[model samples]
Target: MAFHLRPATDQDLPFARALTYEAMSGYYLQYGLMWSNDGFDVAWAGRENWLICNDNAVLGFISLSRDSRALYIRELHMLEACRGLGAGSWVLEQMALKAQALGVLRLTVFKNNPARRLYLRSGMRIVGEEHCFWRMERVCQSS
Candidate 1:
């Protein structure tokens, strides 16, 4: 199924937080870190968020922030049942398009997150490493 993205609203917080926790809680536990939704509201209010939807079904959400040099993907989470169906790739394509004029698109993913493979397939390369995550970037091709 094809998906569409719409600007997120206040009502999406609970859904977005739940989806994020579902996708990352395991990584947090594996890395000996605690998962908390503590500053989600404050951060959410400061970034641009979009809900990934297929008609009336909400499949996931993507959060982003940008600087003159790059568009950073702060978060991208899809429902477990909704993965492996091209949504993540589709989102990446959309983000890349959004970043075309920005020069680059970047994100950080847990070192062992399976999504890293998807990022790699989508043309993102690891440029740096943190204690537990890989910082990746895809340089956009200007048309």
Candidate 2:
């Protein structure tokens, strides 16, 4: 089945946060960083978030923030069953299309996170690093 995206609602925040913790806690642990939910509500309320779905089921969610220079991919978390199914790559492509005017699509991934492979495969290159994260970006061809 093909996955689709829908705008995230307040009801989706719990699922998003749970999936984020499930997907990211290991990385945080490995990097010796704490996983904090302190401001997730405030941050989610302020960003553009979407739920990735297939049929009637949500597979994951993505969060985005934009500025003059680029569209930032704040979060992309999928259920374990959805991983390796091309959903991440598809989301990156969609984000790239949305970012054409800005000319850049950027995200940060944990230094040793396996999802780095997905970003690389989707045309994102590591341009720099900050602490335990790798800053990656894909330059979009503006129309």
Q: Give the TM-score of candidate 2.
A: 0.95
What does candidate 1's lDDT look like per residue over 1-143, in tens digits? Answer: 87899999999999999989888889988999987787777778899999998988888999999999999999999999988888899999999999999999999999999999999999999999999999999999778
lDDT of 1: 0.93
- Which regions of candidate 1 are displaced past 4 Å? none
**Candidate 2 clash total?**
0
lDDT of each residue in 1-37, candidate 2, tens digit only = 6878999999999998888988888888888888778
TM-score of 1: 0.96
Q: For every model in order, what is the number of clashing pairs?
A: 0, 0
Number of the top candidate by TM-score?
Answer: 1
Candidate 2 error regions (>4 Å): none
- Provide the overall lDDT of each model, using Cα atoms, as 2-decimal numbers: 0.93, 0.91
